[model samples]
Target: MIPKVPSSPQAISKALHSQRSKTFNAFYASIRSLRQTPVEPVDPPSPADNDFILSILRANPSLRDTRSYLASFGVQPQRPKTKSEAQLPEIVIPPPPLPKTSPSLGKVSTEEQHAPSPVIHSILNPVYKRTALVKIQGPFTDVQLDSITRGLAYLEKLGMVSVIVVESDDVPKGDLEERQLLIDEVMRVVTSLERQGSHARPIVGAVVRLGPKPGAEESNTDPTFITPETHIFPSDLTQIRSSLRAGEIPVVAPFALDSFCRSVRVDANDAIAGLACGMVEAGSDNPSEDIDLTPLRLMIINKRGGVPSYARSGYPHLLINLDQEYHHILDTFDPRWKESHPHSFSDLALARTCLQYMPPSSSAIMVSHKSPSSLIGNLITNKPAVSSSLPHALLQGNLRLTPHTPTLLRRGLPIQVIRSLADIDQVKMTTLLEQSFNRKLDQEAFYGRLERTLDFVIIAGDYAGTAIVTNEGNPGSPDPISYLDKFAVLPSHQGDGTVDFLWVALHDESYGLGHPFSANPNGGKGGKGEGRDLVWRSRANNPVNKWYFERSTGHLRMGDWVLFWSDAEKRLKIEETRRGGAGLSFIENWESGRLGNWAQVIPKIPSSWK
Candidate 1:
C-alpha cells in the first residue's frame, strides 16, 4: 500500500508539484509509515473555485444557514449598543442661596430719612423743591411793583416755588372790606407781574382766613403789632402744599378766622410764622406726604428795607445773629425811635421768632424793595449783598454802597474778646496768621510788638478768626492813637462770614477793653473812648487794599505802603450832632494833631513778615 515511497529527489519534487494531490500524498505516506494505517490521498480544491464560493456567500442576504455552518467552526457575531446605554446620566446642582445680612448699626440721618423715594414723581419731588416763603410787608408802591414781579419770575426760573403773603397791616387797620380790597390790590399786582413776565407759569391769589394758635384766645389781634401768642393755625397746610405741587405761586392775604369762623385781622408776622411752622410740622406729622415742602428760607421783602442801627450811624445791619445780639440790638433802640422805626423793630422781632421754630439750616432774609432781585440772588449764592461789618463811613457813598443791601439773619456763634495776649494760645495765633496770609511770619517780631502795644484781641468761634488792636500813640498823649495791628481768619472759615464777624468785633465800641468813646475815634487806654479812630497800613500791592479802601474813612499812599484810617471826624459827625457839641473847632484841632501823630507812628511800625 503505501508501498514504493519516493526515495529519489526527482520523485518527491514531482509528487509535491502535481495538481492532482498537493503535499497530502506526502503527508499521508509519512503517517502511514508511523502508524501502518492504510489511507488514500484526496484531491485539493482549485483557487478559482474558492474565490467563487466567497463572492456568492457575501452577495446572498438569506445566509442563516451559513451562520449555522460558521458556528460549527466556532464563530460568534456581535450586536451594536444604543446611545442611551453608552452615555452617563447628567445630575444638576443649584447655586447656594444668598447669605442673610444683619441690620445696620447707625441710624438714618435727618436729611437721608426725609429724602424722597425713587418712585416719587418730579411734581412730587421737583428739581428745586426748596421753598422760599416771602412775607411782603406793606403795599407795593408804584416803583416796587415792576421789580417785585421780576424778582418773583426770576425765583421761578431758579427752581424756587414762591408762596407770597401780602400783609395788610400797613394798610389802615380797617374792617374786613378794607382787608379784601388790599387782597385784590395784591392780586392785581401779582397778575400784572405775571403778565409782564414771560407768563410761563400761572400766578394765583389764595384768600384764606387764618386761625389763631390752638388753645389761644380768639380775641381780635392787631395785624400791625406782633405778640408772643400771635401765630396762624396750620389749617391752610393742605392748600399750600397742593398749590406748591401744582407749580403755582400763592399770593396769600393776612386775615384770620375767629371762633365763629368769621374773617378777622391777625399779625402779618404771625401769618408768615404759621405758614413756615405748618410746613415744618406737616413733614414731622406725616413724613410721607409733605416731605418736600420744608422751607429753606423766609424772605421778608420790606419796603422800608433792613433794620437800621444807631450804632452803625443810621446804616442798616447787614447781618444779625439773633442768639447773641438780639437783646443787645433791642436795647440800642431809643424809646423815641419806636414811632419812627416801627417797621425796623417789627422786622427784627419777626426774624428771631420765625427762625426759632425752623430747622437750624434755615435762615431769614430781609432785603429792600429797591433791589427785590436780591431775593433770588441770595438764594443762589447764599451770601449777603454786602458784609455786615462794613464801617459807617464806607456806607456813606464813599464806596458804591447799595441802599438795597440785603440783611441775613441766623442763630450764630458767640464772640470772645481777650484783653491780654497772654490768654490766647501763641502757637495757634501764629499758625492762623500764617495760614491766612499764605506766607511765613516773623513770630518773634509779631509777639514782641503785641506785648508792647497790644490793646486787645478778639477771637471768633474757637479761634476761627482773630483781630489784634494796638496803641500806636505816645504813652502820655491826650488821644492815645489806636491802630489795627493784625486781622486774621482761618482759610477754612473765609467765605462763611467769619471775617465779617471778626470785623464786627474789632469796630464794636462795646467790645473795647479800654473805656468806650462816646465821640472819640481813638480806641486806646485812658483816651477818648467815645470813638474808633483806628489807623493801619497795607502794602501798596496788597489785594486787601480794595476792602480797606471801602471800609476806611481816608487813605494816603506812601512809597511802598498805603496808610488807612477810620477817623472819628468823618464817622462821629452824627454823634457830635446828636450831642450838640459847640467845641467842634478845638476837637478838629486835636484830631488834626492825632492824624499827624498817626502818619509819623505808622511808618515806624515794624513788619511782622520775614
Candidate 2:
C-alpha cells in the first residue's frame, strides 16, 4: 500500500549500503589513528574541510540535527538517552596503581609546587568602563564584517563591552540580502562568545539622518546617533567635557586639535595643560612650552671652510665689523654728536673707555675678512660689516709713528688707531686690532706693546704695517716724552725746535694762553691713518701735554728727550723751521735747576723744505 517509489528498492538499498561503507571506512581510520597515538594532534581543521562539512550539513535536512546523526552512528550522546539510563547508579572504575616515583621527576618541592604560573596580565584590558560612539560609514562586504567581528572579539577578550550601532545609511542600497548576511555574521560572533562565557555584547541601533538645510547638498548633511549606555553621547562637546572631568585617558588617534577643541567646547590652553600634566605624570621630562615650540639658538659662523682662518687667528673680525657698522649708523643718527665737535670726541672716548674695561660676553665669535674694500663699502652703504673682513688677529704688527713726513704714510704707522680703552691692554688690544685687520699678526709683538704701553695700540690691515714706541717708561708717568713713547709716533718739527714749540704751546694752552685748535677741518680723517695723524698733532701741543711735560721734570731725563728727538729725526727729517727765538738757545737749565737766559745760535733749516 506504500506509494509507488520513484527509484527501485534494490537500487536505493545498494546506494545506502555504499554510503554506509564509506562513512564506516572514514570513522574506522580516525579511530585507528587515535588508538595508535593517545595524544591528539593540535592542528586545526583546514578551512576548506570545515566549509565542505558545513555545506553538507546545511544541504542535508536530516543531518541538520547533529545529535540525531551521531546517535545513528552509535556515538554516545552528551546526555543520557533515556530516563531509565539517567536514573541508573553510576559505576566508577578504580584508577591504576601508582608506580614508585623518581624524586627528581615525580616529586615536586614545596617551593616549586607553590610557585605562581608565569601568566602575563595585559595592561590594554578595559579596566575602566567607557562607551565610544563609532560612526562607521560603510557598505561592508562579508569579509569586512568578519574582520570587524574578529576585532570585537579581541576587545571582548580584554574585558571590553562592545556594541555595534547600525544605521540604515550604512547598508548598501538594493543589497538587503548581503546586509542581512553581515548582521547574521555579527550575531553569530556575539552568540559564540556568549556561549563561551565571554562578555561580548554586540548591539544593533539605527542613526537618524537629518535632511540638508537651505542650499546645502544632501551629502553634506550629518546624521545623529544615540548611545544610552555609559551616558557618552556622540556630541563632541559632551564627550570632551566628560573626558576632562573624568580624567579619562585619551586614545591615540590622529584627531585635529582645533576641531577637537571646538567640538569639546574647551579652550586650547586647557587642553594643553591637561596634556602637559598627563605627559609629566607619564614621566616626560619636557616642559609644555618646550613641547609646543622648542626653541634653539643656532649660530652658524659661516667660514670659508668649517674652520675659518679668523678662528685660527683667535680674533672675531666679522663680529667687530658688524658692531662698528652699527656704532657708525648710531653716530650718524645721534643729534648731539652732530651739533658739537667736542661732544663727539668726548662721546667716542667714553665709548672706547667702556669697551676697554668690559669683558666680552660668553657668546663672542671670531671670523676672517678677506675683502677690506668690500667691507668698507658695506660700512659706507650703511650695511652691517662682517667681522671676517677685519679679523682682529691682523693687528699684531708693530705700530710706528713718524713725525710730520707724509711720505712715511706707506709705512702704515698713522693708520694704526685704537678705538677703546681695552685696546690699551695688549691682549685685548691685539684681539681688537686683529678683528679690524682681518689677518693674523705677531702675537708676541702685539701683546708686548699692549702691556708695555698701556696706551691704546693701533690696528693695521694685513698689508698695512704697524709700529711701536721704542722708548721705555713706566705706565701713567707724567713725562710727555714718556707718554708719547707709548704711542708709535711723536709729532716733532726738526730745526723749528718743534718739541720745544709743542712744549711751549702745550703749556700755553693748559694755562689758557693759546686757543684750542680750530674745529677739526674736513670732518677729520675718516680712517685709521688720517685719524692717528690728526690726534697726534692735535694733542702734541695741547695744554694737557704741556702740563704733563713740565710737571714731570724729575722723571724726564735729558737722555729721554734726546732719545725722543733722535728717534723722531730717524723717521722724519727736519724739513723747515720758523725761528721763534735764537736757535739752540738754552731756554731752561736743568743743572742749575732754574729758568736761565741762553745764548742764541743761527737757526738751521734742512734743504728738504717744501
TM-scores, each model vs. reference: 0.56, 0.17
Write model 2 residue lDDT over 136-246, tens digit each, in one string: 212344444344333333332222223233222333445646446445544554454444334443322211111211232333332321111111112323333233234
Candidate 1 RMSD to the real structure: 39.9
lDDT of 1 by residue, 446-519 (tens): 88878888878877776777888888765448656788888888877654556666676676642222322222
> What's the lDDT for all of these models?
0.59, 0.25
TM-score of 1: 0.56
Model 2 segments more than 4 A misplaced:
1-109, 118-135, 167-610
